[model samples]
Target: MFIDAIGTQHNPATDARIISLVPSITELLFDMGLGGNLVGRTAFCVHPKEQVKQVKSIGGTKQVNLEKVKKLKATHLIVNIDENPKELVEELSKLIPHIVVTHPNKPADNIDLFSLIGNIFDRKGEAARLISELQAAQTQAQLSAMELDEKKVLYFIWKEPWMTIAPETYISQSLKIANMITYPQESDIRYPEIDLETGILDQVDAVLFSSEPFLFKSEHLKEFAQTYKVPADKLHIIDGEMTSWYGSRAIQGLRYLSDFAKGL
Candidate 1:
């Protein structure tokens, strides 16, 4: 029996018909050599873009087509704490026998998730190798970060409401590995909504615009630069997946952050 991140108890199925709602986990599943085992995935689970076509799409992360999921006849389901809603998980619990929910707040958490998924899917060797590589990559990032000068950065996730990634977030922890410091100093809220009128630019060295959830283009950057009176050179568009997604993607993410840190 395996206890998921949400404390759900389940016995691993001999032939797990996995349905993945979390996009990152879908990518992780494919990376862990479990793509052949996937029965269904969300429309948004587009990573390993070519492989997604082979899997059936249920719906989005927040709202999945339960009827469609039922039709797929999945034995196991994969989800995330932040990406998936509780009620949806509860509803799916009745339909799917084994539901594994993962919440990775750091690189270590990701390794644990790999191990858990690997054991459940009987891919222990592959999971061990993945964890080792991720740990090695993270160590390299830490070493690289030691050499780089720390830059005070504000990472934006949403533009409409203007929210910044909080210090407690996984992305912020990942940024620390790259010698990038996120702002405001302390906030219990995960993604705090910001007020541009408050003049936050004075405290930040740079403004990082995310490419996911909210696509921040050059025009938005120009607008922000004008509003904050920040120079254009201090603005950059970051791949959100590299900064946020935790899974096999984090291996590539750490490498990207390392290079991103080097450039800074």
Candidate 2:
């Protein structure tokens, strides 16, 4: 069978040894009922903790131990487009079958990507189920969010330089579907650096801090709240997976967003 990007084919039924380089794709593999086939995973693929415990970790997505990967005899090596360097993928391409999963920063792009992954892994039925579920969840989130008249919110991914989600990003789309507006909705950059002196924070109704890249905790939220003079209740520390990962993990995102809407 032909897979996207990575031009490698093997008997889907017999290709039992697999290595996942991306956390989202690893979660998808598990969701597709291929958890038993996973032989190795990156250190970052920590979902389904039990399954993760069973697999050997090569390293992080950007710094995989190629020697260890080769020694593991992995039949398939799945890498994310942005997470793994292209040179490394090219090098690994010569050793084993590699599948490159392009990161979809927008919700719209995710449609075809999900279908492609399903087709590649011969899990079309599960993919369809997941797609249907996501579509339904999106609809529910939209409807629930529409009922609220909350002000525009700003979502920060990093703290040091203050990086935020852009208008066309997946997180922005999810927030929009949930009826929440982003502060800089027209910015073309998917992840842009924000200027603290720009008075942009004054326009936002709430600030959401994600737990990734920069792990924001209650103390971090308190600092922002004190600095901006915004209420502590306005700062929400959200799960990064819910706002980011565009796979089966999104099934959980819908539920979390729905609950967030109810709270609003």
Candidate 3:
């Protein structure tokens, strides 16, 4: 029954009381029609507003209320490897069955992860439906965007020290499918600090700043534009989840990216 190195037991038939530590996973649970089984969720999980309001908030991904989590007596605790610390996982694992899902930041790999979640929740039909929808939307977005002629774009995740989506990252792959070229396409690191002055930023047709990892507001974008002397319209602040989170919600990303491209 053990799934991986973490000693997570698989119970595809059980309708256990579940708590989700990551927002993306929480959304997945709801998407799979298992929302009724969710007893607790982190504050960061605000996808379906109704579910967010109903579930008890243990805390954010980085900081969890262990006492509250323990008291909830959840049969299954779902966590993301990148969200929680190892020590916390170990501590929680001792108290209850903890399922640690490794974050998949690549476009194709995300499909595999979703399938895995489907198996865990015993909702393969729902998962397959979502995957088909995503694939169809992705195809449509790609076809429509291609008519405009692909534009070179840079997706920024952080600003204090500029960091962008690196090559092989999910965002980068998604951008490529949307017919947008990303700068620094050779780096394998998911997120990397970029040199703005080395002709890298100059070659891009536009720059997209994410509202997470570092919330990039209009002021921040203006500052960046002024500092870089780029056009104001070229700088955009995008929803972080639409660009970063690759899960059941990714089907929504294709539509979001399609709309964003219309603006550009």
- Please, what are the lDDT tens digits per residue for candidate 1 over residues 133-211? 9999999999888899999998899977889977878999999889899988688888889887776787888889999
Off by over 4 Å in 1: none
Q: After superposition, how far is residue 51 of candidate 3 from its true place, in Å?
A: 1.7
Find the 10 residues in a row with the least total lDDT in model 3. 1-10
Candidate number of the best lDDT: 1
Q: Relative to the true structure, how large is the alpha-carbon lDDT of every model?
A: 0.87, 0.77, 0.77
Give me candidate 2's TM-score against the actual structure. 0.88
lDDT of 3 at 46: 89
lDDT of prediction 2: 0.77
Q: Write model 2 residue lDDT over 18-66, tens digit each, in one string.
A: 8888888888888878788888898989988887788899888788787
| Predicted model with the maximum TM-score | 1
How far residue 232's Cα lies from its native spot in candidate 3, in Å, is 1.4
Supply candidate 1's per-residue lDDT for 194. 86
Better of 1 and 3 by lDDT: 1
